[model samples]
Structures are given as structure tokens and as C-alpha cells.
Target: VTGSPGAVITLDTTAGVVFQLNPQTFPALDMAGADDIHLRNLSGSEFSTSVNLVADITTLADGVTPIGNNKYFNLVIWGGQNRTGQTSHLYCNLPIGQYGKQGDAIVDAEKFSVHTIPNDFRGVGFLIGELTFQFSSGGGGTWALIQERVLLGHFPILIPGGGTTTIISTFVDSSFEIFGNLDDTKRIAFQADSITTGTTRIITMADVNVDLADIATNNAKVSNVTHTGDVTGATALTLDLNNLGTETSIASGDFLAMVDITDSGSEKITFDNLQANIVKTGALNSGSITSGFGNIDIGSSTIDAGTIDGTAVTATTQLVSNIWKDINALDVKAEYTGSQTGHADFDGTDDSVSIADREEYDGTGVF
Candidate 1:
């Protein structure tokens, strides 16, 4: 093909690769005929891109205005500002005739790519500042200019800032850029929203080695503990905060702390031995304890309401311990046995009773 005075021409062929001679071409090419193609805009009625797009981020901006305070990096601005007309495209060759249609937008249309800031702008070492943005695909017709947003990427790592700060974990349905710092000393700023509950979304936190003495029966938010959101489950950190130890003032009710689970009162929570100033009534002892007491388990002394089976019983002035007796030594008898009988009435002066069995009694109360 050859250049004309004021007219343009297009040539499309499928007879292998066409090589044009430098000195002179075949005949002056005429593309007006039905057998030829004309070069024109790749976009249709709606201007779609012709090839993959390159979006260079040069500056950071507080607001997208001409006079807005903008931070430029290597003469380029990021945050979708100052990058509209600075885009370049690497086009893909398309045989428009390959598909039966007149032309495929994607064939002539450009693919898109969100480019990172030039390595020169990243700097060698870390300089501390705050940075954040959200990224998403607007639609399929962003051809004239590359639209972009910020996301967590090669940017500087963010550190945990405020201890009382609270933020939604899930950013609705959009992209969430809650990237924390690489340092292990940092923690999350707030409760991250998990759209799902139970099994779907899981919120993770640092494990805590609990010191039981620090946790109180009513309040457990002592130490460096800070909870930004509600927690559920046995393995959650709340379990460690909950004080399972019993308190004397607890009014006939169960006590649950940060963790909802608690040991049932119906079950037994036994210890090696109970050593307290006031020996409170236990499950085995149905009666109430009125005075201060000493250790009951020590010195082989047993304390219980029912018949206890142990060594001996000793009582001090303020201490009273139950004497456990063996079941076999219990003195028990019926009112009357079938073979044995005793007189109902006794002589008033002598005060003696007659038994039908002569051999059953000794001379002291001879039958």
C-alpha cells in the first residue's frame, strides 16, 4: 500500500505475512473496495479500550481537586488523580475477521492493569505516615481513561495505633485494606466485622496466658486486656478472663463472666481439702455453718451430715466436726421380733422387765 494525497487506506489479508518493499510497493493500494479494511477508531459507539491499559500512580491526594493538597512521587500522582491522560497501552494484534462478527470489542479493545507506583517512589527505608484506599472494577466500558483506587499492596506497613479504636472488620462488600504492620508487637485496632457467624467468619486474636489471681469474680478486664467486640465460644479469649472460682456473696445464682459458659452448680467441683475461715456448708453437709472453723480434713477428722466413716472426732470450743461411724456398728432394732418378747409393764419399785427368752439375758436382768 502507498500513501495518497489526502486520503487513507487499510489492507487486511490472510495469505500469510505480507512484506512491503521499501523502494516501491505493489500498486497504489485502494481500500474503498469491499475486499479491503479501513483503519479507524477501535472503539464502537461506546469508547472501549483497545488493549491492556497501564495506570501509573504518581501522586497521593487528600481530595481529587486541582488545588487540593497533593503529594507527588517522582513527578507522578496516585489515588486516581493526575493519571487520566498519562496512560499507555500495549495493544494485541487481532484478526477482526477471525470472528464472524464485524469486530469484537475485546479483540480491538484493550485489557486493563492497575500499575503500582514506580520503584523509585517507594524509597529505600521506611518513612512513617498513614495511607489507605479502596479498589474495585467500576464497569467494562472504562476505555478512554484508566480509573483506579488504592489497595493494600507494596505500600508501607501500617502499625496498630489506638488501643480503644473500634472499626468494622468487614468493609461491607467492597475491598477492605486493613493491612497491619509486619512487627509482632502490634495488635488490631478494632473488632473486624465478620459477615458470617458461627462457622463462616472467624475473628482471631493474640493468645493470653491467664494469671488466675488477677481476674475478679465480677470484673475481669484487668491487666493489659482490652476487648473491642463481643466474643463467643469456649476457646475464645473471654474464657480466660472469666473467673470460675466461687465467691461467698454470690446470691444462689450462677456467675458468668466475659465467657458465657460456667460450671453447673448441680455438678461437683472438689478440691484436695477445703481450708477456709468460715467452713461454709458444702454439698455433703445439708446444714448451715454458723461460726468460724478450722481445717476439717486434717487430723483424720471428718465433717459431714450423714454417717461418716473415718478415724476419731475431736471438738474444740468453736469447732464441731461430724464423727463418721461404720454402718456395721450402728445400734438398730425393731419393736418386736417373732421369737423374742419383753413384758410391756414393769414393777414400779424394782423397775425390771421380763423377757420370754431365758438364755438371752444375763443375771443382771434375768428373764
Candidate 2:
């Protein structure tokens, strides 16, 4: 039967209607005017019919020249029928119009099936599919089933009210790039058994929740870190101070913060004990001089003192050992020599030295 363009033709073989056609003597059936031909069989008995569909490509201006060479035609079958208990075969004849290349020709085929369940089954409506690729080597080579993937279980579900659709699968071997921004409500979550084995490129990680175990191994890989809280540890943390700049001078009252090893607490200390701890070499500019409980050895340096025990001090060429004797004799003479205005002189034979009111010197004349 001939029909208009894009018309669907259905052959219902129910109610004991016999449809028969012989492939050997029947004429070629052209499918250029029809879009699809569906055969429906609702009867319990088998319906045997054979139809040879052909396309007349020789009617072109240059016969069989418009169709590309070295191309494989693909046949797709899609339906909503439950074929869980039935086994069927599909047969087709593909004519090779021309051959131009000497390489292998590959054909990629895909099948899609949708399964509908009851509403009480958690709304579990899913679509399951698989992809297959077949190749034929050389010209007019026998076609072979190169690979077949059977997708029996595991399907992706779609929500009803435009919610998030979740796909549960054991493994996914594909790459994806998402251009849409993800907020708090929209996010991707991986289970405990899930792992990303490849490199993931993320621009910013602000407001992203990451567990401590996720980055535990990558702690050493960080180049820099800034922390506002205190970082405490059970043991001591050693810091390398070799890169610190040198300090030229330290002020007098400035203190240093240090950890006291005695009590293991932080404390502040001044530079009071610096003189006894460090070796002195340079001249002191301006500071109070005090005894360091040791002998003072001024090596070739002059000791300029203003007064020594409230007495006028002077620089003398005498030795320091003999200068103490002169200092002792002058102390006694100042106590005995009273106010004598004139010199008392007498002859050497009967010379007597006396004072007018002193009786101790009158009886003891030794002239």
C-alpha cells in the first residue's frame, strides 16, 4: 500500500487475520513516502510475515552518487514494551552503494529503554541504555559484533517538581564541565566509597565544607598559611631564625619575651645580667660605674678620680705604695699643730720651747 509523505502505517494482525508475503516473488517495497511502519500483534498465536523494504537510489541524476561512500547506516529500535520474558530477533539488509577508502568502517549504535513502575514504588521510573560500536575491515567485509554492553540494572531518576535529580551508579567513567554556579542548596556529594581519581579544577573554595580527613595528607603540600587562632602542640615547635635580620642596638629598658625553661611558661626579662654573661671589648659610652665585686685592672688607661674619701686628689709621680705613708703623716700633723702665729727660736746651748699657759711643757725643758 502507498501512503503520503510522513504517514505512519500500522498492521494489526489480531482477531485471526492472516497476513502473508513471499520475499522471493514479492516486489521491492519503497519507504521514501512513509515515515514508519509498525506491526502490532495482540493475538496469542504467532504471526508469520516477511516484507523486503528497499530504497531506489539509482533514480538520481548520477546513479548512486549522492550518498557518501564508506559510510555505515545505523538502525535504532525504541519502545516502551516490557521484553523481560520475550526473546526476539531483528533482521535487515544494508546495501553498500560505493567504496572509496581502504580503512576499517565503524558504526556506533545506541539503545534507549524506559521502564514505568507503580506510583507506590517510590516513583521509581528510570531510563536505562547502552552503547555499542562495531567495525568492518576492508571492502565488502563480513559484519561482526565487536562489542556489546548490557545495561540491566542501575538507572538515573528524574524528579517531578524540578528538584535535584540524583544518579546512583557504581562507577562513572566520563568527564564533565559544569558552567552553572552552585549554591548551598545545589551541590555534589560523594559517598564514602566514592573517590575522584583524576585532577579536579576548582577556581575558588569559599564557603565550601571540607572535612579534616580530606586534607590531612595535603597538610605538607601547602606553601603558605595564615591562622588567627593559637596553634598549640604537645611538644615544642622549633622555628628557624636564620633568615631574621640583625639588630644593631637594643634600648636600655627594652625587654624580651622568652619561654622560661624552669617552669615552661612565657616571661619577660631585661638585660641586667648581660654584662656577666657576655664578653666586653668596646668602650662604654655613658653609664654609671660600679664595682663588679672583683679587682679593677685598668690596662694602660688613666684612672681620673675627682676625690678619694673627701680629700683632694692629684696625679703624682710617686709610687702608689709610698703615697699612702705621706697621706698618714699629714693626717697626724693637722691634728697636733695648733694656731701658732710666730716662730719661737732660741740659742742651741740653752734653747727652750714653751707655751705661756701650758704647765706640761715648763717642767719638761730638754734644752
Candidate 3:
């Protein structure tokens, strides 16, 4: 019949034992020390008969309290025949059901039946001890069975190695395919070296689309780049002089990079062409005033000098000729004003003449 928690059920060759248990209505069951069945020695006439025992365990317990909902438990039955010295064990997991709720139609009920037969015509006894019930919650037993079946039938088993190595092995013969979309958090990271401090780059859908916003700092290192389109940004671009090649001298044919705002593209101009444009429209055509004297427009500027040497000065204009004439006239006046043998000296208001004699007027005169 009906047995409560920790109920003892004994079996004999001449009789049978039956237990009916409902885990939904019971508190908990712990038959560790009380559920062992002791078999009595069979008589000579009963040696050919077999003893049958049935047990129904519906609820599982941790200690004295029942715990779990929708749990699938494992039942392990182990025993031995002392007379025959034979030992064996049977293990089976329970089905998924709600064992915690009372009057639930999904409650799982398990029944186990054991048959004990005598070894021969001799009197033999059997002892079945230590009936253990292990329980797992949240369909753990079902998940374990699924995993086991997949491992037994799936292709390309996973082994312990690096992630790349594992992926190569998994798709050795076939291409790897993903059916769903991946976000930023789901990325493939790789590094050039195996050092711990090496730079690591992550590749995602944004990276494939060349989205600069999703790029990490110091991760985009390009050696050389050439673009025909305009490259514009909010801030000024700085070039590293140390990374560029040095040139001690430049030729007129040498080209320099420049942006063409008119065409909305990038272009290059030679040094000769650039210089010609500057000379045509620039204020100064030469580096020094002496070399570019013809092109210079002095325009009302005063010239201050200590001496204007006659040999160095050229009468290129009427102003220069007039200046020389004025200096020569002053020298002639100074000589005539000096004392002479016959020459007359005229003051502002009086005129005077000095003569030694009549001979002096002819040729030999001193005054």
C-alpha cells in the first residue's frame, strides 16, 4: 500500500510489498536509512519462486524539506546477492514535471519494480541498500540529454585551443555561416603578435563599412594613402616632419601637393609655375633694390646719403643733369671771387680792381 516519508518496505520469498507515494501531496521523502529492503532466506520448496517489490517515489528532498519545481531527478538502485557474490546497479532519470505544486496535472510520478530470484535449490538471501535519488531543477536533466545527443552526432568536435584555431577546425571542409545579425559587442579581435601588450584590433560590421566613429584610438595605422577626392575635416591636419623624407634643395620642376577648391579635388603644382604666378601679381619682383631698380617705384620717398660720388652716379634723368650744373656754377663763382692779378672783385655794393702796373695788365701782373 501507501508509505509515508522514511517508510520501510521489506520483501520475502513468500510475500510481496507495494508502495504508493504522491510527491505533490507529501512534504518530502528521505528514505536513506529506512528504505533498505531485507530479503529472508528462501526455503527448499520456495527456491524456484521470485520475490517482486514495487516502489513509487514522487517527491525529492534535500534534507527534511522538499525543494525544487519542474525538477527531473535521477534514481540509482544498487544491490548484491551474498550467496552468489553478484553485484550490479541500475540508473535512470525521471521525466520533466511540476513536483512542487499540489493537484498539478503535470506532476511526474515514477514507479520502480525489483525482482529477486534465488541462486539455486540452496537457501539464499539478498540485501538491497542505499537507494539514492538525485534531483536537478529547471530541466537540467533534459538539457544534459540534449547536449549528450548533439555531441554524439554533431560534426567537427571542439577541442582546447585558441579561438582562431578552433574556428579553422570547425569549418575545415565547409564555410562557416551565421544566420543572425551581430552587434558591436559581438566582434572578432585579432593581434599581430603574441605579446601581452601588443595592439589589438576588433573587426565588426561597422569596421567592414569603414565607419570612423566606431574606430578605436591608435588602431588605424596606414602606411601610405592616395586619394583623388577632397579630404576635408573640421580641424586642421598636421603632418609629422620626422616621418617624411628630407630635401636639402628644391628644383623648379619639383611638385607640391595642394587642394583645388575650384574643382573640389586634389592637385599638384610645380615650383616654376608657382613662382611665375607670384611674380606677375606680387608687390616685389626681386630680392634686392639694386637688382630690381627698374621695377621699383620709389614714389615720394626721401634718399639720405653722406656722399653722392660723381663716378658712381649716372645722369639717367634731367634731375641728375641739373644737379651737376648747379654744383659747377658754384665752383666758377668761388674762383672768380678769389684775388687775381687783373681780375676785378665785385662786392654786393662796391666794385674794386687791384693792378700792380701797366705791365701787369699786359702779361706780368701781381696784386
Q: Best candidate, TM-score-wise?
A: 2
Of candidates 3 and 2, the better by TM-score? 2
TM-score for each predicted model, relative to the true structure: 0.18, 0.22, 0.19
Judging by lDDT against the true structure, name the best candidate: 2
Q: Model 1 misses residue 113 by how many Å?
A: 11
Residue-pair clashes, model 2 = 0
* CA-lDDT, candidates in order: 0.26, 0.28, 0.26
lDDT of 2 by residue, 232-297 (tens): 655554433233333445454322323232324443222232333323444455655688799666
Q: How far off is residue 220 in model 2, in Å?
A: 3.6
- For model 3, residues 129-150, the per-residue Cα lDDT tens digits are 2122223343322111100111
RMSD of each: 20.7, 22.1, 24.3
- In the range 182-257, model 1's lDDT, one tens digit per residue, is 7523422333354455556544765986565645443444554444444444442322323334345533332433
For model 1, the superposed segments whose C-alpha errors exceed 4 Å read: 1-174, 183-334, 337-367
